[model samples]
Target chain A: MHIEVVANIGEARSDDLLHKTVIVVDVLRATSTIITALANGCKAIVPVETVMKAKEQVQEGDLLGGERYCKKIPGFDFGNSPLEYTREAVQGKRIILTTTNGTRGIQKSMKADHILAGALLNGRACAQAAIALKKDTVILCAGTQDVFSFEDGICAGLILEELTYTLGEKNVLINDFGLAMRGSYLHSKDRLFETLVSCANGKKMSRSGFHDDLILCAKSNIMDQVPIWEHDQMILLPRSLARSTF
Target chain B: MHIEVVANIGEARSDDLLHKTVIVVDVLRATSTIITALANGCKAIVPVETVMKAKEQVQEGDLLGGERYCKKIPGFDFGNSPLEYTREAVQGKRIILTTTNGTRGIQKSMKADHILAGALLNGRACAQAAIALKKDTVILCAGTQDVFSFEDGICAGLILEELTYTLGEKNVLINDFGLAMRGSYLHSKDRLFETLVSCANGKKMSRSGFHDDLILCAKSNIMDQVPIWEHDQMILLPRSLARSTF
Candidate 1:
C-alpha cells in the first residue's frame, strides 16, 4: 500500500484521513505522554483540540492532562511532559488530554478508519500495528505551533524507516515530505538522541527547562504498547488486541 | 535570519508572507517555467490563480502559459515546459501564467515585500538574490496538487544549500522542514538528474511525455538571472538591476 505524509497538521483534514490508517507523531511530548500514561496503566486517553474542550470532556474522576505553549494550564492535573506521568498519578484512571499541536492533529484525524499514536518511545509497536492494519496509510506530523518542527519530522522518518525495513517488498510510495523525513532520520539515527536534543523543538524544550522530557522522548522503543484510536479515544493495544481489531 | 518553509501552498496565507522575502519553488514546472520565460528574454510575467484570470490578463502579444494536470490547457500558448520558452518564441513578450499549484502559491505570497520564483534551474541565483535582499525569508514549495512533491522539496533544499555555502556565518535558523529538505538535497545532489527522473513527479511527467521538461529542470545555474517580484509582476533581474533595486 502507498503511504502519504501530511507534513503538518495544517495539511490534514478529517475527510482526507477517512478510511486510511493514520499515525500521528508529536514526538516532543504529546504522543510520548500518551504512551507513558498507557504503559503506567492509565485506562484511556481522550485527545481534544483545545484546553476548553479538554476541560469539558473530563469526568469527575478523570484527570485533565495538557499544556498550552508547553506550560501546564493553571488547573490541569498534568502538563504534557511524559516524566510527570507516574504510575501513582495516572494508573487506573482515565485522562482527557490537550496540547498545543498534537491534540490538534488528533482532532483533525478522528475520521481515519484506524488512528495510531506514534512516538520514538513506542515506535516499533506503532510501526507493526500500522503494517498489521494493512491499509493505505498517512503519517501526519503535528508541527510545533502550527509551523514545521524538526523533532516531529525525525520521529516520522523513524517510523517510515521502520516500515521500510519490515515491509521492503511491499509497494509503498512515500511523498516528498516523507522521503525527506526518512532521509533526515537515516542521517541522524545513530545519534538520534543528540540530534533530537539539538533540533529546534529540542532546544526550545531544553531552554524552557524540560530537559528530562527530551531525554524521555529520545529513548528508542522503550515501551512496547501501541496506542490505537477507536471512536475518538486512544488506548494502548497489544498485538492480540490489534490483530483481532478491524 | 530564520528560514521557514511552508511545505505546501495550503499552509500559506499572504499575510504571513507580509514584509518577508518569499522564495517560491515548483521544480516540476511552474517556477521552472517562470525562470525559463525570464531567461529567454521575456519582458515580464504575471502569475494569476485561475484559468479565467489568466485568460482575462492575456493581451494579443501576452502569451498564456500554464498547465492543468501536466497537460497544456486549451487555448493557452504554453504548457509550463521550459523547452517551450525558446528565445525566438518568448523573447520580448509578456506572459500571463496560471497553474494548478504554483500560481496559487504566488498569489498567497504577494503581500511579501519580495517574492521570487525559484527552481532547480537557477537555484544558485535565486539563493543569492534572497541573501542580497536581506530579509526574513520563507521557502514556499508549490507541492503537486496541494500535496508535498519531492522535486519541489529538493529544489527548496538546493536553494537553502546555496545560501548556506555562500553565507555560512550569517545568522540563519532553518526550520525543521528546511533542515530535512537540505538533508535530502545533500543526499541526492550528486545524482541530481537521475534522482529527478526517478522522483514521483518526474515519473508522472515522463509517462505523460514531458521527459524533456524534466531534463530542462534538472540543470543547475543555467542562467544567472533571478525572477524578482515587484508591482504585481515578475521581472528577470540582472545583477546590475538587482544591485540598484533598493
Candidate 2:
C-alpha cells in the first residue's frame, strides 16, 4: 500500500514499473485531452511516441489529434485541446494521440501492471481508481520537457490528497517533491489558476497564448471516468471505485 | 532553481541532464563510502560501473573495495562498507571503489555539467554545493537494484528541505516524487531508520542480513565535506555553499 512518486516518465522504465499500479499525470493538455475524449464517449485512444508513428497507426477512419509545441500539426483533425474533444466530435470515434510529452510519457509506461491517465480534470477519479486496485501505487507526473511543471505537480497533489483521504495515511507514500506540491496547493488554493500560469513551464505556454488551456486544466473533478491503459489502447471505466468499500 | 528526482541511473540518461547540475545519491553505501573516504583523508577514489572495470581501474599502489549481493567480491582489498574506510587504513592512499549500485550511479552523471555525491551524512553539504553554483539541480537517487528505495528517497528529502530553506519557496522546483519524499520525512521524522527498514526494499535488505548497513546509513552530519565530481575525480570541499548563513 506504499505509494511512490517519480519525477517524470523519463525517470521510470519497464522493469521499475513491474508489479506496481501506475497513475500517469500530464496536467497541461495531453492527459486532459485524453480524459476529455474518453469521457465524451470515444471508443479508445491509441497513444504513440512520435507523430510519424501515430500517423501510421491511424487507419483510414480513426481521427488524429495531438500537438508538438502546443499547436496542431498540419492535417491533424485536432490539437491537444480539451475543447476539441466533445460528444459530437469524438463520440464513437477512435483517436491516435501523439503529443510531444503525454503520449511519449504513456509509451514509457507501456509495461506497467496497471496504467491510468490522470490530470487535474480527473484527479479524484484517478485516486479512486488507484485505491480500488488494492495494490501499491506509483504516480508518474509527465513533467514539461523533463523539467518540473507546477501544473502537473499540483494535479499530483490533488490525487495524493484524495488518495490519502480515501486510503488512509498509512497506505500513502510520497517523495519530497510530492509533499511540496501538496504544500503549494494549500498555499495557493485561492489562486490555483494564477499559480499554474506562474510556473516556468506554465509561463512558456502562456507566452504562446495558451492561457485558455491552463484555465481548462485548472478545473478539478470535471470528470469521474478513469482512463485505464489496457494492452496498447487507453480506455475508460464507467463507475468509480471507493477505497473505503474496497 | 528546479530540482529533478530520478528513480535510478538507467532512467537518468534522458537528454534533460545536459547543461544541468546533477547531484547523485546512493545513500545506502556508495555515496556514504565516498564521503567517508574523503573525510577520513583518502587521496582520491575512482568510481567504476562494474566489478571487472573497477579492478581494471585500480593502479599498482591503490586499494580496491567492492561488493556484490552484500558480500565482498573475492580479491578486493575491502567490501562496500563505510566502516572499512578508517582514517588509519586509507589515509593518503588512492582507493578504487565499486559496488552493485553506487558507482554506476556516479558514472551515469558523466554527461552532466556538474556532478556531486549526495548522502544523509553530507545532505546539507550537497545542497549547499548545488546552491553555490547558482543553477538548477537534479537529484538522481540511485535506488537499490534499479527500483525505488526508501532510504535514498528520505536522504533526497533532507537535501530538498535544506534547499527550500536556503532558496525562496518559488525559486526551488521539485518533481512529484521529490515532494512525496519530503512528506515521508515530515511524517516519519522520529523513526526515520525504522520507517525505512519497514519499506519493501529495506525489508528485503534486512532479511538478507544487511540490517547493520541500514543503521549506519541513518546517521546524519557524520561528514561535513561535499564530494564533487571534477575532471573525472571525486573531490571533497570544506563546506557546502548552499546552506543559509542565518
i-RMS for every candidate (Å) is: 1.6, 6.0
The model with the greatest lDDT is 1
Cα lDDT of model 1 by residue, A125-208, tens digit: 777788888888898989876677777888888888878887782567777677778777777777777877767888888899
lDDT agreement of model 2 with the native: 0.77
What does candidate 2's lDDT look like per residue over A1-246, in tens digits? 677666666666768777778888888777888998998999999987788998799997899988776778899999877888989999999999887677767777766778889998888888888878877787888886775566777787788888888778776766544554554454455667886776666677799988888898888877787888886888886474433222
Question: What's model 1's overall lDDT?
Answer: 0.82
Model 2, span B1-246: residue lDDT tens: 988777566667746777788888887778988888888999888888788888778888899988877788899888888888899988998888886677777777777788888888878778878888777888998877676666777777788888898787778767655665565455555666786676665676688887877787777655668788876778775453544232
Root-mean-square deviation of candidate 2: 5.9
Best by TM-score: 1
Clashing pairs in 1: none
Candidate 1 matches the true fold with a TM-score of 0.85
Candidate 1 segments whose C-alpha is farther than 4 A from its true place: A41-43, A46-78, A86-100, A198-200, A230-233, A241-246, B48-78, B93-100, B194-200, B230-232, B241-246
